[model samples]
Target: MSVNALISNYFTTGALSDLPSDHFIDGVFVPSERGNRMESFDPGTATVFGDFAAGTAADVDHAVSSASAGFALWRDTPPARRCAILMEAARLMRAEADWLAVVESLDSGKTLTEAYGDIHGSARLFEYYAGAADKLDGRSVNLGNDNAAFTLREPVGVTAHIVPWNYPTSTLVRGIAPALAGGCSAVVKPAETTPYTALMIAELLIRAGVPAGVVNVVTGTGQEAGAPLVQDPRVRHVTFTGSVATGVGVMQAVAPNVTGLTLELGGKSPLVAFADADAEAVAEGALWAIFSNAGQICSAGSRLVIHRDLHAPVLELLVKKAKALTLGHGLRNTDMGAVNSERHLAAITAHVEHARSRGVEILCGGQATSDPETGKGWFFEPTILDGLSAQDPAIQQEIFGPVLGVQVFEDEEEALALANGTEFALAAGVYTKDIATALRMARRIDAGQVTVNDYWAGGIELPFGGNRKSGFGREKGLEGIDAYTRAKAITLAV
Candidate 1:
């Protein structure tokens, strides 16, 4: 679709067009509370996608109350039935892949390639969880002759989910799949900049035999809808995927309630290229690792710790490759795309500016502009920074854009130290030929997951998560189910 066409059609998007007439509650799509409450935007183009009646505190209360009312029925709902619904949801996701991809690309400033990958990944997550839905099991234990014991995993009831704008479609499903598979109902609050995809899911899940109240979305401010969603005593769990600060704030809201939490937060993950590695592949993978999806990933390899010997060559190649990346409208074929939101653009620009003011080298890109031939949109050069200490704010902090900070390391230990310096322990990469060193670095790196000799480092089944300030609990794997549930032990007299 052409830029003009997409813009023209944006206003006609009806994901939430009938919200006032169709409320999602208790397995039915009925009228939402009477109001023209909130609007959604296409962050890439700065256009209003559509509006929905913003769900109020009362609305949240209604959803949770409805979910709570359905818990016993849903939890006792045979696991096979739960699996079937999720399986159907996956089918619907596959059917709507194109639409969701377009919606994601429109809402987030990601290339169509990135957006397609996100929607595909979301479908895969739901499918994976569907395959595992009926696999939730308990174990019987023998307590020496006289006593018997067993353990069962039970759903934590209604869950509150909040997503960040970076990977809106994918993250929502990433949280939603496991919650549904565990027999828990979810009330999701998508990032304000990109809520349409959530509405898209609500639409599909409703069509896929999901009980309406089982998956409700309320679009509003975090303080308004988000806080209550988490604080509602009826909500037994809170799963948030966003920045460290926002994740912390949400946790604080649920603290008094002690809601179960699986907070997937941010990272300043590192990529270490030792001297023995393939220069070209590492350079390309390094660029892709960090700048993929314009470096908006929570596990973006934003820090580079290259060996002293290979630093110059690798740096030169990376600079050339990053500069060669074409940025423009996400719909058109481009190696890179625009910043997802203006706020994100500002955050990226601010980080780069602060780094430059403090004397860190501005290796490339810290500006935004438009292509006249095409419609106006946000674009940034894939940026790199050097000549800064490890503590330099540019290298230490997350810019959350297509910005990479280069810091050379004398040897393995220094590389590991520089990588571990950030409060985020989400992901790290080690490029080396020495198995001994790789194993040693693996033990030393302070991250939950480390990629060696490659940059294909994220997904649904890989137990993706972080430590320290990167937030806690795991997602995208069997552990995600564990994260969403509590283990119950039963014992008998010996």
Candidate 2:
């Protein structure tokens, strides 16, 4: 069916039909023990579309217990059998990519195209981990003739995954795929606003031969559901992706148990352009860096630091392109889409307004808007603010919106300083033809991942994470699987 037809059939009068409203636990949908429900809004229209279980401490405990039991069974299951199950899950994900993309767009207010890519990435994550499942081989150490030594990789037991709202399916799968591949069963707590896709993914895993209780989903507010899951001692490992404040909270909650943790917090990453760089390529790269997904990405290149000689032309190009971006419903496949919710729209507005009050130049848009046709969505204009100092709040803080801050630098040293000014060291981008300059910046930049010519150059195979206040540990690629595993060294006399 066409995309419009599917939307019309499922979403009528601001209410969705056949939505997954209950938590998926023990391979079945179950109501929360508290019997509470929270309404989820359609950010495109700013109206209620569905409600999901308001998970509480009791619900979290139940899910964790189920995961613990499943871990016992799954960890003992042969690696080959586990590999087959994960491969089948990836196949199911591919078969339902279209439907899953639609659901993701509805829940997260991202463009249909971006949502489609997210679904594809999600499937690829499962596929990648599946390929690595049976290959987690231990290495033997060469010792004296009468002595023998080897190492073993083992699952860290039941794990808790606290998924953020933005990039719901992608982030959820990014963490859990490796956990499952490493033989750990998981209890997931999806952001309340975007829980539908998490539940749906769990259901798909169950259908793909993941045994009962191997994957569970609980949806609710962070304070109630997330804290409990993180604090649960039965959960031996925790994977969380969100704000630095919350990531800190996760660390505190896990402190008593000393549980293993992996955190991918947010970033105010930079896109540095040199005077010798191709202006056209830099403009295009800058556009995709900051505005893709309406600039809600943790790795979004929100700060543009360019040489003084090239700033004006690049700024003009960026303003022209940013002004022309179309915004509306995600299903409409516009150039941009709504910011996740009304609250988020307000936050973006506040940041822009604060910058403007400080006499910063508002090069283009600086106001909140709505869907031009329906006039109801929580939308914000693509914004560009200039004349900001290195310590400006707009430059240092993670606005988590489509607002780009521009700064000019005179030379390579100044550019490097500005790019690495913020507490976030998640990701950065460098655009220059000079190989030596690119190599120097790549080595000196504090970010975990630095792309030389492109803002987001790598794929699912690359390792991704952050440093300093942006949180620690890595996700994606082989390093991702390592987070879910514990290493044990063995020695013996033969």
Candidate 3:
């Protein structure tokens, strides 16, 4: 789509029938300086969804400069007015919800339900932060003599965000939502593979009355554009959501500037099913645990620990459910879908192979299926592995696929220990009817989000983050809104 048409459709809310091969800079869609391009493949058909200008370091600098320049005015744009703009953006997002889903499914192998839900979820974030925009008030502090003191929540100028490909559209929204709400300007470097949705989102932001340079997106390889953006001194804050390794590297890259950091990184979240829990509900939750988005979520329930007394029956039901899923494209109303990319499929397969070598027992389907109707798509069987201890390699690492490693425990002490065995502390669940047990585990579990007799995680209105090695800082909820702001104190005396 040409710039003219894109802007025209920005108001018309047409289908995502046209994709412009460009990066967004200074609120305008433009071609990349580096003529090199990257092609996004549709996981459903292994077809080219679109090609985008592969951004370079210079492009990152250009975006950062524009955002920084824009910040001088945007940061001071009264909170009430900023809220109006973001609220408009949220409304615009809802208006184009169908188009957003289509673009997301094409660019990211997202299921219809997930792609559409992501758009809705993202819109909620905008709406939520929009309301909180003007609510960012500083409280007064009492002091001796005739003195007045208080604090102000100010925007950390020129923030740079590096969002992951798995949930690019939403993750970028996670950062951009609060930045815009907090009256800050941002330069976003979206994942190279899934740049289309980001471009489309930038268009919505512009239509919502966001001024030029308030938000810009540059896409490229992480080693170049992502790293440079993080390292840039002008970026007062850096927000990233990806792997632990990448987050560590980004931390080191941004260390020189004392930049504010918010990282929503990887996870090996545990799902524990106690004997007292409802068997049917537990089995169904386990299915949702590792199969949603083909288990692309960082907080996915990849590890399932069941009580030994009920393990056999639960395992039988789980295996049966796992094998019965229908694998196809994300567009249809199917039980399952293709993996996101060739690289992700390869990694999932490698993890399964590694588990098999480590004397793990495969309880069900553990291989990939290439159905032509799905277009040589990368669909993997939802796998369950028994004969694995908490210390098993599969249990200790984040496979980020549909591979669930089951570990049996005799007591609550063992369950908690096993759940916390991995370095990741992103998310975990305890399924138990006993309120005491649920409360105990909720307090003891080394995870950011803990649920009782349920599989609740990832919501725009909830605070999501991790403890220990799972990375730091919160995204979503009020903390997420505050994460984009820097609190400053001011004092006055007569």
Candidate 4:
């Protein structure tokens, strides 16, 4: 069916009967061992659309045991065969992109356009890692005569992926694809709020020739499903993407086991615009940087650090453009969509209210709103806070909403200070006409990824992760697979 047709069907009936609502274990859909279930809400409508299995510690144990066995079989599979299976999975994902996109939009409350991009990006991740499956080459060294030394890259056995709600499809795929490609079996614990897409993707992998038990998914709350999976000693690696608090918890859970870990955490990233930058372009970039996904992104450019000369003009343009943005259901393809949940909506409201109380100027929008037609969804206005100081909580902490805090700087040094003032160092953007200035800012910024002339510049080929409190390790690019594999030194005597 066409994308429009699918969307129309959803709004007409408010039900998607075929949506998977069971845990996927050993390559098949199964009920929770405890017969427990959890409801998933449609954030756009603030209504419960579906329910899925709420996995328990027993379920996690079952999935892990299945994965352990699967890992042994997959590890011995030829790399060429592994590449072929992953490539087929990518093809299947593309073939089903429209359906997956609609599901993602409904599940995550992102606009259909963004959901579509995420689905395609997920496919691209599979494709990228498929090509790398057979290329995990080791190195050879000459120790001396009659002796040879080399290194072997091998899979790290069973892996557990703890996925987040924001950017559900892409984030889940970002971690699992490389691990699967590297011959490791995965037991995914998708965020309880967004579990369908992960289960759907696992089904697609099975259809594309992945063996039973190689890819399993358990759905439930973090405490129930995620903790046990991470704490399991049999699981060799864990990749997590979420808030700093949760990442820390995952670290604590995995510490006893001393398992391999990769964390992509929260951010309060800045967008630094020099005086020479095009104000109009910088304004547009700012809109996309923070407002996309309803500003639920971890690496969102939530802080605007602009040169004093460009600050007024840039803020003016940003406020004007932000006001013009349309908010609605994800299926409607509006300029912006609802926040993920009512709880998140309340959090955003609290952030804005606290800022207002502290005398931060509300340059444009700073109120909680709802969908214009139904007036039911959890919506927040695209807000801009003007008189923010480095000490303000809004400037120092991650609001995780469509709220931008404006700060002015007199020179490059001041701009850098404002950009790096926050505890986060995930991502940043520099807008300037001068190459030297752009290069210098990129070098000096503490962020993991620094985009020049644009806010979200690079593709999946770029390594993405953070420094400091934003968490460690990396995802995407060639480095993405490194976390899932380990190196072993081999010596030969003749």
What tens digits encode model 4's per-residue C-alpha lDDT throughout 1-494? 89888988989888776899999999999999999999999999999989999999999999999999999899999999999999999999999999999999999999999998998889999999999999999999988688889999999999999999998899999999999889999999998889999999999999998899999999999989999999999999999999999999989989999999999999999999999999999999999999999999999999989888998888888999999999999999999998998888999999999888988899888999988989989889999999688888999989999999889899999899998898899999999999999999999999999999889999999999999999999999999999998999999887
Give me candidate 4's TM-score against the actual structure: 0.99
Q: Mind giving the per-residue lDDT tens digits that candidate 2 earns over 76-154?
A: 9898888999889889988988788888999999999999999988999998999999999899998858788999999
- For 441-473, candidate 1 gives per-residue lDDT tens digits of 988998889888886755678898899999889
Specify the highest-lDDT model's number: 4
Counting clashing residue pairs in each candidate, in order, gives: 7, 0, 0, 0
Give the TM-score (vs. native) of candidate 3. 0.95
**Tens-place lDDT digits, model 3, residues 179-246:** 88888888888887788888888878889988899899888788878888999999998998989988
What C-alpha lDDT, on a 0 to 100 scale, does residue 452 get in candidate 4?
91
Estimate the lDDT of model 4. 0.93
lDDT of each: 0.79, 0.91, 0.84, 0.93
C-alpha lDDT of residue 96 in model 2? 88
Candidate 3, superposed: residue stretches over 4 Å from native: 1-16, 372-375
Off by over 4 Å in 1: 1-23, 28-36
RMSD of 1: 2.7
Candidate 1's error at 137, in angstroms?
1.3
* Candidate 2 wrong stretches, greater than 4 Å: 10-12
Give the TM-scores of the predictions, in the order they appear.
Answer: 0.93, 0.99, 0.95, 0.99
